[model samples]
Target: MRKTRAVLVSAAVVLGATLTIGATPAHAETLAGVFREHSECERVGTRGTDQGWWDDYSCEWEGRYRYYFLYA
Candidate 1:
C-alpha cells in the first residue's frame, strides 16, 4: 500500500510538471504606423525605445518615412 501511494504521488508530480511546462504564453507581433517626415519617424522610434520595444526606421525621398517596432 505504501509503495503504491508513493508511485501515485510521483506520477502526479510528474504530470503536474509536464502540464506546467507544456503550457506556454503566446506573444503577438505589432506594427505601429508608417509615419511620414524624418521628425515623425524619429518620434515614433524614440517612443518605441522608451516603451522597451525594438525600433527601426526607414526613409524614402525627403519626406516619406516609416518606423517599425518589434517586441520580443
Candidate 2:
C-alpha cells in the first residue's frame, strides 16, 4: 500500500510539472541597448513591427534612455 501511494504521488507530481511547464506563456525578446531619444526608440520599434522583425513594441522612457520592449 505504501509503494502504491508513493507511485501515485510521484505520478501526480510529474503530471503537475508537465502541465505547469506546458501552460507557460511565451516570453518576448527585448532590445539589447538603450535609446538616447524616444523618437529613435519608436522609430526602430515601428520599423521592426512593420518589417516583420517583431510582432509589436512599446517604448518606455526611464532614467537616461528609452527602453524598447519587443513582443513576438
Candidate 3:
C-alpha cells in the first residue's frame, strides 16, 4: 500500500509539472531596428518596416509625425 501511494504521488507531480509547462503562452515578435519605406499623404506619413527592404520617396508636408530606424 505504501509503494502504491508513492507511485501515485510521483505521477501526480510529474503530470502537474508537464501541464504547468505546457500552459504557458509563447512570445510574440516585434518590429524594431529595421529599414522601412516612407511616404507622405496629405500631412500623415505612412511607413512599412518589415525585414530590410526600403524603397520609398518623401514629399514635403506640414504637421506630420515621422518615424525612422537608425543603425549604428
On lDDT, the candidate that comes out on top is: 2
What TM-score would you give candidate 2 relative to the actual structure?
0.64
Runs in model 2 deviating more than 4 A are: 21-23, 26-33, 64-72
lDDT of 3 by residue, 1-53 (tens): 99999999999999999999888554323332423333223122234323233
* Candidate 3 TM-score to native: 0.37
lDDT of 2 by residue, 6-62 (tens): 999999999999999888456645663457667777887788888988786777657
lDDT, residue 37, model 1: 58
A best-first ranking of the candidates according to their TM-score comes to 2, 1, 3
| Cα RMSD of predicted structure 1 | 8.4
Each model's TM-score? 0.39, 0.64, 0.37
**lDDT tens digits, residue span 1-72, model 1:** 999999999999999999999987654334555544557666776777788776443333333333333222
lDDT of each: 0.60, 0.71, 0.45
**Superposed Cα deviation of residue 11, candidate 1 (Å):** 0.1
| Regions of candidate 1 where Cα sits further than 4 Å from its true position | 26-69
Once fitted onto the true fold, the runs of candidate 3 whose alpha carbons sit more than 4 angstroms away are 26-72
Candidate 2, which ten residues in sequence have the lowest lDDT sum?
63-72
Worst 10 residues of 3 by lDDT: 36-45
